[model samples]
Target chain A: MKIDTEKLLMIPGPTMVPAEVLNAMALPIIGHRTGEFGELLVDTTEKMKKVFQTKNDTFIITGSGTAAMDMAILNVIDKGDKVLNIVNGNFGDRFAKITLAYKGESIKLENEWGDMAEPEAVKEILDKHDDIKAVTIVHNETSTGARNPIKDIGEIVKDYDALYIVDTVSSLGGDYVDVDKFNIDICVTGSQKCLAAPPGLSAITVSEKAWEVIEKTEKKSLYLDLEEYKKKYNEKKQTPYTPAVSLIYALNVALDLVLEEGLENRFKRHEKLAKATTAGLEAMGIELFAKERARSVTVTSAYLPKGVKDKEFRGLLSKKYNVVIAGGQAHLTGKIFRIGHMGTAKEIHILATLGAIEMALKELGVKVENGVEVAEEILMG
Target chain B: MKIDTEKLLMIPGPTMVPAEVLNAMALPIIGHRTGEFGELLVDTTEKMKKVFQTKNDTFIITGSGTAAMDMAILNVIDKGDKVLNIVNGNFGDRFAKITLAYKGESIKLENEWGDMAEPEAVKEILDKHDDIKAVTIVHNETSTGARNPIKDIGEIVKDYDALYIVDTVSSLGGDYVDVDKFNIDICVTGSQKCLAAPPGLSAITVSEKAWEVIEKTEKKSLYLDLEEYKKKYNEKKQTPYTPAVSLIYALNVALDLVLEEGLENRFKRHEKLAKATTAGLEAMGIELFAKERARSVTVTSAYLPKGVKDKEFRGLLSKKYNVVIAGGQAHLTGKIFRIGHMGTAKEIHILATLGAIEMALKELGVKVENGVEVAEEILMG
Candidate 1:
């Protein structure tokens, strides 16, 4: 299992793909136009809708979660259409950029990098921009380990005449997104993040409200044409072009596993693991990352001892101790490492990742007051 | 495996994934930031370049072939830039649209849908458009079952300054594409066609000249940014965003198998099998969809008998024989049915597919000879 002298991935997605899912993908190839492929497509779609917690239209495309984020804009925003994007982390900025790709006239309702969007910021944007065609935000920001106030923001957007797009890339399976209660027009997620499969596709649940707006879009699109794909998908389970069939097979199995676990239990397990890990990190004197309000249970970003950059220290963990942790991206690079507790990760896995970090920190000669002692206290004793 | 009562895929892409490739993908997950993930990334890219027939910098992304095709344009094309494109099938039309998606202008020089791109037609376009920034062509048009005169076209392009971009999504591993000698600036391909991995990633090799042009591209991008990816990828084998890791693992194994068979042997096997299949179809009075000038060896498009429409015939094949073939796409819908000879396909598979078609045609009461007799005579003789 150690690929080329490397350790296992205990982090969130690309989570370890199960043998059954991979075995399912290994089944003989079927023509995408054939009945067998169509049934597989239909089965996967039906199961995905259940996971989305919606009776609405659900579909998939052969791309990463980022592609789903991109499509949310392609389907809803017109060229030069004003979009109100709430930025909390890298993903939120990307949502805004996707709107920009299609020439969307957009405004980023700013916040401290790790701060979740407040109802007041969204209300202020909606009140000011009468021309705004859509309100976009991330349901969970994995970069800084923050979950936004999506339900609260959803209530604020309901009064406005604009589409609401939410990126649930890292949170959909680990937590309940409640797309209906959140009034989300487009809720997107990827299988690799929390569904425990290989990465290749993005599943997006679209509302009738969003579909109506997309029908009138003037963008010269062929691939990301939501209405076109929807029409063809309805006639048959076939996609407009060749789809990732094996990924779909893997998706079907992964969704079954998720449902078997039950959404409430899944969310609770993630919460417990996150709380336990955070408590351990704190006891070791490592502080949790900034989040003005809400945060996700899937991951926690923590600052290393002052002046002990994550770049050198993290490399040592992977190279010496066989553990992997994400360095702070962009401005936060070299400042912290992110611990993921999503998908199939367990309490033991969390502790193992932490222990490696403690070992790496100790070798780096950083200020530490018996780090493993506190971590073991919460995780074991 | 009869999913949703739909037939299995036997057409060009989304081919049956081999168990070894799937098992390779099922390896335990590794953290994306750790050296383990980075090492895999590096090794995967190295093997991918070999599959692409180029030593130029290659990159992997989580998307279908279209995604890679579009990325080729995004990095190299600017708004209003003119591109000379040769359209022979459904995929060629997609390339044209992809160019337009980035607001780049396309000067299309096309043959009939089921015909090859004549070398003279390409030369004529090259001579006419001095402003053409690049010349794009599909190596194999799956819908048409035709291969363009790439070698001849390559000689022609080398005479001009236009960057030659090739879409070898179906042809790369099954057939030989000499990127260096063919003067290809950007060569793009997907995993499922002949590589025999699951459908999830699209890879591309970029020559230095193409990189220079990409450097000049000022179009705003994030996820699909080629320059940024190349920089980070060279320094450390990591993508800007989380990669399709499982698909990459599958691709690595698929590439190994492709190389094990040896590229020359693979090409020759495809050529021999293609001839036998075509001879069988012809003996049964089924006309070839591809022209005589350049027929692809990986897929065969057969004109259905007088009374048969695509959907009805394919359905009967699935229900009765468990055989699958693709229907015509775009304006050619119902005109021809395509049988893919790529991926884990060998002589026996092709023989069975052809035999099933004959049975299906007979079931539909078409006037024809015995399919098995004709096929057996061609292959065993």
Candidate 2:
């Protein structure tokens, strides 16, 4: 059946973009090589650096976050090179897969799906494998709604020879990400997540150490080659190939709104949203999937109610209340649900989503508490 | 100096997008995993196949046309595999580079920049190397405005075991490309260009024959992996990763416009626009770059008149007349200029661009005939 209503996206990514950002993309398409596009590219990239809190060389790629993640691993890992992958969720596991796909030897420090990667485990792996050329981690795992201890792991990996690569696809704009202080050699993020922009464009920051590794590695991908991007950006403030011009226009405005909101304020807002969301779920007798201390500020994952079917509940919520949330991915499918409160999501969205969930649960003959009231209390407090 | 007016895009790929298509992107973002997105994806892909004139398995990649090109090569050619690359322009040369980057041995049949590849030359190369796994060529070269003899080349490649891979990045919607009739094993095109959608999204059609080769080939790239894309499409009508959702929305609308126009009528329109543009330039005492029979129907390239500087002339056209066109790429830089008249570009756009060029030339004190009147005569006739 068709849901004939204005649907609100509460997915982990491709989040709810603001009207201003969405309208910015409706502006006329411009030539990628023109001076106008160059200015837009430069301005957007500079602001992205401020949000990333790094002075490294930044580039915008015309692909999904997976492309940026692929670029991060492929640029540094050569054939037979050992890469240490800290796997806590799907995205972190993807790093391992990318490395393996490129003929690199991946040594995964595996953690439970909802658990965060321990810094001690990473340190032990690095200490054991002296030949490891790169270490990859996900700062915020969208799949399981878990946030890893990036700074703690960074401090441990800094003394090693391996370059530190982090995927901040869901965290850069919603959480505190100090790329330099965290010693992340390569940090990647998507435009649609916390930036509140349209999907399809991803940005990456490369440190000097990462460049050194990239330069020495034999290039395997022509489209994702970092050297070409660096050369093009240096010569002219433009991408090596034709960029997704309209998406960049949307992202430029998204970055403006993000900077205007102030990073600290935005991070605090995300924390509050996460707190309220979890509080409401807990008050409804739902169990949080992620560990308490390592919960993601962007997305919250929780167990489905005992008698509630995954599809029926979400379907009811979407059709009846016009609130769309994400189902569990991969192994977690049918067992849990995730609510994304990043980007343009506000307190009102959290309350509406909780209210919808409460009604949907009661309709299914499952007992639920006043989730809306509990969420409203936290939002007001 | 800034152009203080609404600028028109006349570049080769990122052509002018219709307001309807652009506004379609302004719709709110949706969850990629939802049934709504599934319907959107399935409907868009079916329409895209009609535009591609193929019933082959197609997948939309959330990257630039280059990404599709890379996928075309990387999926079929394993390490040290021999591939015949017919190079006539920048993009053809790029295919060779991608093959070489992936450790494939490239046998290049190089042609002049403004010339199309002769099918006999391709037959000669395939005859010499029976080990050639695939034959790669650009259907329409964007840099030099040359359209290749793809059907002729496809006939020869089909005789051999080599898979036929074509890049229709700049020609798919505007040109006559019957993928099934032409026996194209893997055909790739971008969402922009003749599709008149915003940039960023690219689509590829894979024949059963191409899939057989791809399935056996050792996959090197996780992001550009066609096998994964095929599996994902088979399981669900969704991309393997988060697609540029808004761009897909724009492309859905763009495809509706394309199919509504009918492919035959669209091709005729592009042909007429190209003819008028060329007539105007020739009337102004300019020289067309590509050969008479190989001229592109989407974009027309011509030599810059003597004593008229490339930068200053184009700058005047852009700033004074608010018309944006592309200059020559690579070695042809400063020697030629290109006018794109594909998708959403009609007779009026062609006339306005030519008139702007004439005025910009007159302002530069260059002697010229009334090019606009000449173009009008051709267009009206």
Candidate 3:
């Protein structure tokens, strides 16, 4: 409702939020301890359970996606516990780092960026390490635009004694993720990513198994302790601390849109968009950075065209066309750029992004052709 | 702009936000890594320095007031260090608890809930315990509606080797606190408080002295680590993690309003309103909970009328009059109620709140007279 319609936001997370969701967030401040706020929070949690596709207890944290990951790890694992971290990208490695921060021993099952973690590899590690307390994995790796095989790995983890933790920060709403079916003990996602809400809130669902682990572990950080969160939520349907009330309102509205569209349909729409985006970039003679079968539906990663500098190309899109996209992170920086197509994004948005890229590349004297047409063809099909 | 203005929000922290701030938040989110967002963040930090009254590095975090306090402690103290905690209310005690959670020893100088922490007492403790690494104090205690003597304590702490950490969650924008003059090493506040912005974001100012300690301490949390925050901020003027962009945008606008009004005028306005509220309640034959000189300008804590039921009185105000007020917490529940008049709250709003309370009390068979008239008279002056 208050958005500047001129500039289009296409970042992976902090994706383009719908006007309806923005309007919901724009609603006035409510007392966090009031019955009205409690009722609102309870209702929103119920809706979030449906989005998460889980019967487990869901709680909201007033922080970024990384904070959710911290909660999932810090609550379940105690100091000196051995945790298996499956790393394919930046966020996965962050899981190991967080575990280490909590004094847990992180045994990382490493994979290359833009590659998926194999179920067999995870099975081998779990079989070898019977004392592992928990296993952390990223469902969708935004850093390299890769989607890990969470369901396959979840099936393997279900048979093990270790608690299964999944980070679905970039995929939850846009991709197919049934938390219960995936045998997830703790599933984490952020409001800014596929939920089409602003950043600063993370939605996390916890299973009974995770709670058992949490009960045994000492509270690590006061603000992030999940036991405190659960107790406060169960008693009064309120968070242990003050939450981002406006963002919660926005998330509820965004979840309404997701449910209205239907989860399966939303997943299919994202899949189609991902396909179109990949096909268009390929048609433009640009190579996608992600390996086949591991690419993400929410974001598409690709190498920059020859002669087109990363900054110059991105600047052209932002400054000239009023379209903004993200560049690569960490080791991939300057070599690639990523275009996000999640949460309120449509075929037109995808086509427009490609068209702008095509024009920008031409201005830079890079040889590229029919990017928009190729994207439109794929989207139509 | 989307608020149900009929139901006034008169609560400490998550205070009523202005229409302009809300509208600014509702605007479309931009990429966090974009030049535009970086410029916005830099400009906001500059404006925030004016509010904080310091040349220190101020970083915005995505969490409540407690998280900022957690950051202040976790980043400065290592394991097995001694810290002095000044406890007057719930939040002050929480600082000690956090210090203990990090394995630091906390020596508490306790005060009654409604009483203020004495600077001389702190100096005595410092005199006794020269090994104390840091001293944590609360500028405004929301639970008891009391304001501590931060400037006085700051003067004492400046002579010592300990870091002076102040929690200004409920007082920052409404009260006078010069961080530089007060020798505050780490000063923290939340967006939902007197800033008149939404929750889920905290603005914390870290002095060079505090940073020196943080540099030596091992990282406690990946999410709340100020050292990581400073590095990323210094490199690109961006947070290490994705921030609540909408809330930041809203905070920038809210800070604009605060600066436009002038800090001195804002503090005077809060003082006058606080006096009016207290006078009006006393005129209605209700007693104020906070001590005379230590009363908070943002919130007023008061004893319920003899025959009035806490739930029944509050229920009538919400259901019948469409107004909301807060009841006391922990041991003070059912004994007192709190009325918040911070951020975007005007004299007319205070008059309306008192009028509603007067009407509710009358319905409950409590004889009350001239409550609104008294408030109006004080406000008129």
Candidate 4:
């Protein structure tokens, strides 16, 4: 069957953007130093704080989520500083890599890819290393569809001297992240995930405690320097460098959509979507990848049916049904597939994606049935 | 008179983007890992090579131009490495700052803001600093509207053992940048400038010699690391991190527009536009800021007429005429104003901008005459 050329993006990030947000991005470009852009920057930063559930000073960086994650670490962890990294999935491991790259001593608390970081393990590590300057964890591990217990880790770290840093790149709007309430010192998120905006822009909220460390740390990066950003924002309500102006416009509108839907409502919708996706996949005889308690609310990971090739299945789904999904990364490649239902994804997208997966599996000689029906049951309920 | 709320950006960067390029950016977001996006990435990179007029390996980065500049310096200069930075304007000084931030000793070859870097001075400095690992210069200083003689400096630097790094952030697409011919080991440019694409993405070209230096340099930045980007691109035609997907789409189209117009034709157009802008300003009794030999072909810097206030004049232009221009940066603030005539700017924009400036100057009681007519004569001729 021939499908429309526009393929639905069900990958973890660069999620489907809304027309309103896209239109906002399509608006005429504006100078970053202008008062008009300053107003936009201030408005977007304020709205972003609400989504983060924090009153901490937030900065919009013109790079990927990793840039924000890098900034979060590089600003606080000076050379030879000890940092505790909780690694459960790909992005979690990335923090450790970034820490090591900057010559910081990284002590990682490890977990299986499909499992969440244990709060007890993080506490034990922190207890062992009194010199640890920060504890870093990924709120949602998009690679394995696992959601870590960031709040629990935050609680344990707050009592210690180590600053609490969390990468909420794929989970900020889709999941509840009470940064201030959880005593998070630094929280980072990207625009392309649950914000339903274009990629390339990331935001980080910094508490006063983080600033204390940042101010004392030696300058390591000119572009990712948070002190310069804070100074510029304080003086003119602008970024130190020219920002991704169009993406800023898009993010402003995306924030409007998120606030209009309400944070709780958005989280509920993501939960419902995750439930539908998992239910549909399980009903189709596909095994869920992540542990039940660690399942992510934005993306769902499941094993391919026996005898179904990963590339063939995904290609067939994309070419024949115009549905796009993600394959596993690193060691899990070709063993699992991930479906993202975050941001602008709706009940219809879930049904269509499930139907596409079932069709592909059946065509590949795997016994599968009632996937869309099961998804509909959960979504409608 | 009341004017439309839509602003016409005449800033040196975040230049005006065409509607077509903006519409391309509005397209549905695609997963970066998809074959479709890979194809787009390859196409854009290939076309970018053409615009750069080089056969060197180029990578698209997900941050502003400063990120690329930072990447260029940090990737090559290790701690205590000596780098010669030719400072003629703000961006030139920025290169020195990035070097100093990374703990590299910066030797400055200082030129006045409105003057070009002297080739003999660069050679003399290189002769003195035989241990210098690199020499950095800005091809076009956006802050001062001065175009340095990159080819001349490139010729001098090629004889030295040091790598030649050039920041062409505001010049690449609108000016002639023969990276290979100029022997630039590393060149950086931003998307929002002459590319006429939305701000946020920057591209860097690394020569084989530059890669050798980069490979041996200690890791300082994880996000701006060039090695990871090269590895990812060589393994699969993709960025190491998730790219600004929408901006990439927009850039693909912008490159198409650029190539369609032809490089020589585009350069000619830009030169003509620059001529018209300067003529218009001069006719309005404004003094050009940059020296004759150093005048940039992308942005024009001019001193405000007697009794003309920078903020008040720009405010009148923006509020009454819906035209926007930039004020001087750093120490030059409130003393001069800059007019950008790059990217999608044409004769009509130049005329309109000139007329608005004339009206503003007249409102401030400065005598001005035939500015628009003079600009039209240059453009139409």
Candidate 5:
């Protein structure tokens, strides 16, 4: 009954969970008390700060990345408060929707699907909204292959006393974002993505300023009560809610793996792999949707060739190549598809994914050049 | 680096996750959009219905039992909505606090710790408040070891137009809770307690009547939004947001194990275990904290001797015999300890826990009979 994962999971989240990490999760569930539980929490939190590259308090929620987004927005942005949401792709829109649901006056600054949220537009919107209390944006958009200029955007929100809430869902361990240096009041990451754990928990951090906002704000939330947790976190290394204990165990292992690899090395590897992935796709005459702001790693969104269907290519990849890739969302459906190379990925994985694409293209009668050749040319380091 | 857990998890939740269920969780992460994902959702939902004993629409959330309680309240009860919350233990107070946070006018029906919410008290309260929209109660109070009579409480709320919401956190699989026959509108349960899965996601069912109230209510929520999930569940068997995929896999396996044991036999076994546990404890001259209402098989609170401290006894039990038990909360702290025998329990575990308790008492120099002989007599039956 013990099933070993045969396929290396390369999906965006729910990424490859190492055997050691899985076994760590299978540790007998202990009471959320005991010195053992406290020691685990303290160690996990301190290690989390190492990855987040911030001294600010890190609180892990027994939920998903979206839940973290909800926590960040619901707590920081008070109802009827002016806020600016920069939407570039799916995740950005989700943040905007979340901000709107919190009764925040959401002023949207949007861009084309492939484009990044422009710095000029954000600055302009901020200049106009004198009452704006917070401005939210995603560091990495999982839908489109784009990494926004979060550091630049974080700087923009600095002077205005507005809280900078960053959704670094797919970018956390792949690249570094020092929340303290960047003046980010709120930063969030998921366990399943670059952290390379199973999908269950979302790791979050809030600044002193952000905590102040949360304290005064009215929340209809009982689950993501940040202050409640912060209170408990201050006293005992415990969450206000019953946390996903096993997932926390898995996350600790994943964090250890990331640290062992070293952050700079991991980021550089992602950069190299991303370039190779883009090179491989272009070799097949397929243009990626997000050409201008193409992210270094984690995910890639590429255009489909004429008469080539995305669903067919994905199916063929799954059935024949034993690979899985994401198709385009609404309005871009059948036009583009996304491939991910997050935690536990390397040069070899991108090469295989492109190799599958090559086979799929040939079977679908699309004229294509060899992919691995181009991939090697870009990734050979 | 791989740590194998042979130590049985005898706690109320994160119960002994069988190896097969662990294997199921370790299955390769699938694309949430692919047919593979759809198949998992559809299959899980059907099995869930069978387990819940309800034909109502049920959805899973990546949260603890507390989150389920919050979602249940937030969805149906709005600002100024009158709610009657039965508070007898920690979890019951959780319901009250959550209701109050939502700006819901809740009547707190105070029941003694280690006592169930009285039916006559509920009837009297209901007679006074025609504005009451919902009546909330916990099925099993792990904090006090009391199982509320949902059958009688449901009948109390049945005559009124108000919906009945129940927290079956520790008793869903261990005991029979007929969601349909009991006239329960909303029921929430956690995976770890009796379901024998790790703690991460919580499952809840909403009846058609509850849906009507939720539909009419205008509330602002994002991550815990039940309405958003309802729209997606019917079409895609997908959550509006990404889910804790692997935990769902674990639940799938855990459900198989529970259904295999069958409800009737499972409940009978739990009842027998409860009887034996009480008889054995009494034979050793220890008094039960919840004798007013029979202790639930899932969890039960027991008082220590007047001279011996609960924490000191707990220390002896853990250090000597490796047995873990729940301690008292708030006012009850150091006065009582709780033992769980919910999931994956056999005749031996109960005796082992009792044997440990006996040894701890004797070591603490407390007056006590032979723990092993009394426990053995009850267990042999």
Candidate 6:
């Protein structure tokens, strides 16, 4: 199957990588055990720390973001340890499920699908369960397109002695995350999301406090061992196993682009795109699924129009307009559609995506007009 | 630490990828959930079955060969299941470690590092432990360059009720292994080795009986679950998690190359290179590490000259001659070196590699001569 290479990809993760990063990946692959790859690994780790906004040691593991999330849970918490899991969406609930899978006791504080994780609810739970060993939360819920109040949650957790672990799989480079200031013990981000590289590598940062806990626990898994990574990074700046070398090369180029654009400007770009896309959808008489304050900057989620079918509308956009967007996951499927604006997308691309949606809506007999103009107005301002 | 990109990669895994395969990987990234990617995944799976010599389900997982090795064990064998692990070298030992990590009871059948797993030895162990749930072995041990008699071992294993799983990580596409005829229940291979793709993906073929065992077992992992892959493949031909899309594209092209060359011809090519390499090393008065009958066709292992240091000799080849070979791993480190002649390397490349070693040995005052001539004589015949 030949890919439509010219299509504008607007998925939530695996967002469009720039030509420069793609070119970097096309370069010849070096041996992973060689000094050349070791140097690249070290340089990528240093740059990843800048992107993660932490002074902690950063390591890249050869798997998806879920691997990093699993490692974070399996390494720190032993069986039967009490973990306060904040669940607002699919990813948040996944943390709770992973805790259960590893035989940990999870005290779940679940909110509605589109609701942001509230600090007061978390504080109330922590007040009741003082034996909580770790507080697990998703900073940005990918399934519902809601940005939880992790800074406030982090502040509340610091009052207690629970280790704060955050999954920023959909945020990191596109959104602002101060890992050190937020008192986060473990932070996880994926390569395909805001990093704008290909999928397969996950970057993680571990604070000193988390390492102490990890040092005391036996390894639950040989594949996702944190101590193995720590030993390899400290001694040789190499991974314990063979890594995805070409993906690392792409990530190095992607991180350089992130630094070149400056973090604040990149965050502003994501915010602007989110606002423009949301305004365009609202002008078409559609309501956003996420609450106003909790709307994610990387992707904008909205309810489908009364007459439009989710699959048909998405098919028309992809086949005819060459604009591929993401559908809702889990329970939100067919109820909502997501417009991703993370990494490498600009004002013009956002306008084009809105125009394609408008055309698809017209074809589906939904009364909508001037969507591109609405988006352009917000983007220009 | 920029790589000498022009150098020939002669390592066991991550061998030289053909230009066509490299170009396929350079293609633009596509969404994992897209129909385009689904078609590619389906096509690749079908072609992988042909290469694996199996009629069972083949899965493309987004990790190293070790992930496939890990999955083969984690999926079928539950905790406390008795497994007879045949230990010939490092990878064979790793399979036992994985079994123990997952709380399984393992009975090890030991052999020396550079020796093959004898069929008689395996039969003896199985007779003693008739209650063994599974038998794990490696077709080709990458570290020791020893190819075990898996076909013979498989004949002995068919008498028992134990499931037979084999790791063909370094030998799948380049060597001969009839998965069905050998009674192999599960076989694991990597894209980077004899398949001639970049390192990131592992393909595994599972028989119907193995799937029955997997269906009855509870999920031990979310990532490496074979049932999850089977469910996704049957329903929509999609991976349950985000995959390395670019690597899969490369694998598709590499498999096409393998089929075009014909399986028998590819196996003959590997055998020819192995013979030529062995003839060249012997002419230089170097002894092969592995026994004569057990030497691997993909990589040739030889003891380093008495007066020459492994590092200095390998460094001279890489730095001056632009030919990168592999040093010994684990217990054999500094004692032996390896030369790989797997996928995409031709007879001329083998002669060139032998010439590089000859020049390097002369620089190290080893007095080795006519290495390239000896290799050419064998290749011509």
TM-score of chain A for the candidates in order shown: 0.95, 0.98, 0.98, 0.98, 0.96, 0.98
Please provide, for model 2 over B1-381, each residue's C-alpha lDDT reduced to its tens digit, 9 standing for 90 to 100. 122228878889799899999998888888888888899899899999999999999999999999999999999988899988889999999999999999999999899998899998888888888899999999999999999999988888999999999999999999999999999999999988999999999999999999889889997999999988888878887789889988888999999999999999999999989999998999998899999889999989999988889999999999889999999988999999999999889888998999899899888988888888888988897
lDDT of 4 by residue, B95-194 (tens): 9999999999999999999889999999998887789999999999999999999999999999988999999999998999999999999999999888
DockQ scores for all predicted structures: 0.47, 0.66, 0.64, 0.62, 0.59, 0.62
A301, model 6: CA deviation in Å? 0.3
Q: For every model shown, what is its TM-score relative to the native structure?
A: 0.92, 0.98, 0.98, 0.98, 0.97, 0.98
- Candidate 5, residues B311-353, lDDT tens digits: the string is 7888777766887777887789999887888877778888888
Better of 3 and 5 by TM-score: 3
Q: Residues A1-381, candidate 5, lDDT per residue (tens digit)?
A: 232344544556657667777767656677676656777888888888998999888898898899899998888776788878888888889988888887888888888777777777888988887888888898888888788888888878898878889999899999767888888999999988888887878989989888888888886688888888888888877887777877888888889999999999998888888888888888788887885554547788888888988788888887888777788876787888888888888877888888888998899999999878989988887
Q: In model 3 chain B, where is the ten-residue run with the lowest total lDDT?
A: B1-10
Best by the DockQ measure: 2
Clashing pairs in 3: A3-B28, A28-B3, B14-B192
Docking class of 3: medium
The C-alpha stretches of model 6 lying farther than 4 A from their native spots are none
Candidate 2 lDDT over A54-146, as tens digits, reads 999999999999999999988888889999999988899999999999999999899998888888888888888799999999999999999
lDDT of 3 at B218: 84
Instruction: Please report, as a residue range, the 10-residue window in candidate 4 chain A with the lowest summed lDDT.
Output: A1-10
Model 1: fraction of native contacts? 0.50
Per-prediction interface RMSD in Å: 3.2, 2.7, 2.8, 3.8, 2.6, 1.5
- Badly placed stretches (over 4 Å) of model 5 are A1-8, A294-296, B1-8
Residue-pair clashes, model 6: 0
